[model samples]
Target: MIVVNLDVMMAKRKISLTELADRVGLTPANLSIFKTGKARAVRFSTLERICRELDCQPSDLLEYRPDEVPQNV
Candidate 1:
């Protein structure tokens, strides 16, 4: 399962969800979905905006952790 590090990043930057949404020109509801990692897709432009506003790299916003694959019995 993919996990969002938004809470962690926000803590590190001391930025609130509303703050991030305001900076990124997105609605708090939309940003909240992204923040919670419930988003199925993200636009490149949006990603760029987010990175710029957050002063962070894409990798900072996202991470990959390989989970154990289920094996057939």
Candidate 2:
């Protein structure tokens, strides 16, 4: 499964949701959805802006975790 590591990245950058939203020119509501990992899709331009603001790469914000089948679980 794909996972967003927004929380970790934000923590590492010590940025607040409001500040990040302001920096990215995104509404707080939109940022909140992303921060909470509820977003199903993200725009490339948005991602680039975020990476630029956060000093991170897209790889830093996203991760791929192999699903453990029910049997493994």
Candidate 3:
């Protein structure tokens, strides 16, 4: 499973959702969706904009955690 650490980074940066959204040229609603991990997909351009605004790396925002459920049944 992939988890988004956007809130964490936002906290670290002490930036508000509205502020980040404006900086990244995204709407607050859209950014909120991504922040809450409800987004099914994200474009690389969007990711790049976010990283540029947050001054963070992609790895810092995304984390891969293996699901505990067994794949082979």
- Give the candidate number with the greatest TM-score: 3
- Please identify model 3 stretches exceeding 4 Å from their true place: 68-73
What tens-digit string does per-residue lDDT give for candidate 1 at 1-73? 4555777777788899899899989999998888877787789999899888777888888876678342221
- Give a tens-digit lDDT track for model 3, residues 1-73: 6788999999999999999999999999999988887788899999999999999999999988796432222
Q: Clash pairs of candidate 1?
A: none
| Candidate 2, residue 32: lDDT | 86
Model 1 clash tally, residue pairs: 0
Residues 1-73 of candidate 2 have per-residue lDDT tens digits of 5677987998999998899999999998999887766777899999999999999999999887796322221
What are the models' TM-scores?
A: 0.80, 0.85, 0.90
Regarding TM-score, does 1 or 3 come out ahead?
3
Global lDDT of each candidate: 0.79, 0.86, 0.91
Off by over 4 Å in 2: 68-73
Per candidate, the number of residue pairs that clash is: 0, 0, 0
